[model samples]
Target: MSAIELEKDGGLWTVTLNRPDKANSLTRAMLEELADIAEAAVDARVLILTGRGRVFSAGADLDEAKAGLALSPVWERLSGAIAALPGLSIAALNGTLAGGAMGMALACDLRIAVPGAKFFYPVMKLGFLPQPSDPARMAALVGPSRAKLILMGGQKIEAPEALQMGLVDRIVEGEALLDTARGIAADTLTAKPEIATGIKRLCQG
Candidate 1:
């Protein structure tokens, strides 16, 4: 199966992590596939991110993590490319999100987490610092102090707690996450596309 699956239903394109057995841990091929999809998504009105398994994503693939020997440059650059996609991006968190997985969700413009899903950004847990942009992105969403608490403590927050901390826009039933994200995307299509793109660009800037 393709590590990354793209579903196009009219103006919306959903990119799904297809490695259910691996908790959708990002393999090198998956990352590159996503980047290519992002480039191809410019014409789409909305882009949805989710996973095939119950767990949205466990994190990076350990076998492929050795690629960092070259300085992890590919991961950072590909991540920015996906997160900065011009179309509206939404993450439907069906289960646990940790490590680099947290970065993936935070990259989305809005995130809807399922009842049992949890979130943690534990770069420090690996004894490596977060990418410079990771902190800035976190600060933009949840502010400095809360971001600092997460980064410093490497604490994992449950769904309700994640909502309180502004990590997710809403908490929904596990079965409803994908439906809710698609509904939001349909709603976005009702607005003027240029205006929406402009606002998103401004926020990214």
Candidate 2:
């Protein structure tokens, strides 16, 4: 199967990160596919982003990253494109989420994290910055100090702590994450499509 799969269900477009053996770490080709999906829209009422097996995304694929960061540019553009999609978008964090992958979650309108899963960004530990937009997005959600602490600390937090820190909008059992995400996406998608995109963009500002 493709590393990333886009499935249309009625009005919902479920984007699954399908690299189970690699913990769903997205690649350059995957980014291209996602970009195409975002640009098309094509009657998607809602978009749910999730992962296969156990991970939403374990950030970059270390091997590919070491091989000169294969899909960095594509992913950067794709992440921004997904953020501005017309459909309601929700992140379904099934397991460990980190790095640029966490940026993907931040781009979503809402995040539903499975309980006990770890949420963190350790870019600072690697002597690099979080994605340019990450701090601002995270800060908007959890406030500045919390964002600084979490991102700078470079330490992982469990679901309960992540909730306390406002990193997760909702928490559910792993088995329930997709259902919760779809319910949220469906509820939000009830709004007029154009209005949904406009309001979401303004709120992001």
Candidate 3:
């Protein structure tokens, strides 16, 4: 099966991370596929990123990392592709999102996560530095102090705490996560394309 799955429902397109057995960990092939999908999805009115199982993504595959592969550049390209998408972007976080996987959610314009979902950034613990742009982007949403607590202190933020810190835009109950995301996607699709794009551009700038 493909590592990523794409589906279009009206104007909303969903890109799902499908490697459930690995907690949806990202591999080089998956990263390339994600970038390609994001680039091709610009025409959709909204794009929702989600995962198939209890973990949104476990981050880069360890085997790839141990073999001397640098995944940050690939992640940067994927995040950039998502950010540049003209359509409204939403990260429908299904469960745990950790390490480099945080970048995917950060790149989205909006985020809706299940109540028990967890967010973690362990680059410091892993003896790696986050991409230069990551800290700034996170700080923009949750201020510099909290960003440092997360990145430097390696604190794990649960959904409620994440909501309070503005790391996630909204919190929905377990089974209702995708529905809430679809509702938001519907709202975004209702707006004029140019207006939505302009608002996103304004907010990001």
Candidate 4:
């Protein structure tokens, strides 16, 4: 099976990390495919990123990381693509988000995670830097010190704390996760494309 899956329903594009057995851990190819999808999502009115199982993503596949995927530029490329999308981008995290996988989630315009989700970025422990935009994006949501707590202190933030800190916009039950994301996207999905994107641009400003 493909490690990544893409589904389109009108102007809503849903991207899923499909490797449940691997905890959705990413490899170089998976990262590249995700980047490609995000880059191509410019016409989408709303884009939702999610995973198939209990873990959103465990970050880089360990064997691939040991082979140098940890520092790959594709990570930055994928996150950048997501950030640059003209439409609303949402990370509907199904479960725990850890290590480099944090980059893509951080780049989304909003993040809503399952109540059981945990957040962490352990670059300090792994001896690697986060993707170029991750620190700034994360700091923008949760503040620099909290960003440091996760990146430098290796702290794992539970869902409620993450919500309080603004890292995640909402904590949703597993079954309701996608429905909630879709509901949030409902307005954008129905609005005129230019109006939706214009508001997004204004908000980014």
What TM-score, to 2 decimals, does candidate 4 have?
Answer: 0.98
Where is the poorest 10-residue window by lDDT in model 3? 65-74
What are the per-residue Cα lDDT tens digits for candidate 4 across 1-205? Answer: 8899999999999999999999999999999999999999988889999999999999999999999999889999999999999999999999999999999999999999999999988887878888889999999998999999999999999999999999999999999999999999999999998899899999999
lDDT scores in order? 0.80, 0.79, 0.88, 0.94
User: Considering lDDT, where higher is better, how would the candidates rank from best to worst?
Assistant: 4, 3, 1, 2
Separate clash counts for every candidate: 0, 0, 0, 0
Candidate 1: residue pairs that collide: none
Off by over 4 Å in 3: none
For model 2, the superposed segments whose C-alpha errors exceed 4 Å read 198-205
- Model 1 C-alpha lDDT per residue in residues 131-160, reported as the tens digit of each score: 656787788888898888889987788989
Error of 4 at 66 (Å): 1.1
Q: Write the per-residue lDDT of candidate 3 for residues 105-203, one digit (tens) a residue.
A: 898889889988999889888888886667887998899999999999889999999999999999887688888888887867999999988888897
Pairing residues by index, what is the TM-score of model 1? 0.91
Ranking by TM-score: 4, 3, 1, 2
Candidate 1: list runs displaced more than 4 Å: 67-71, 201-205
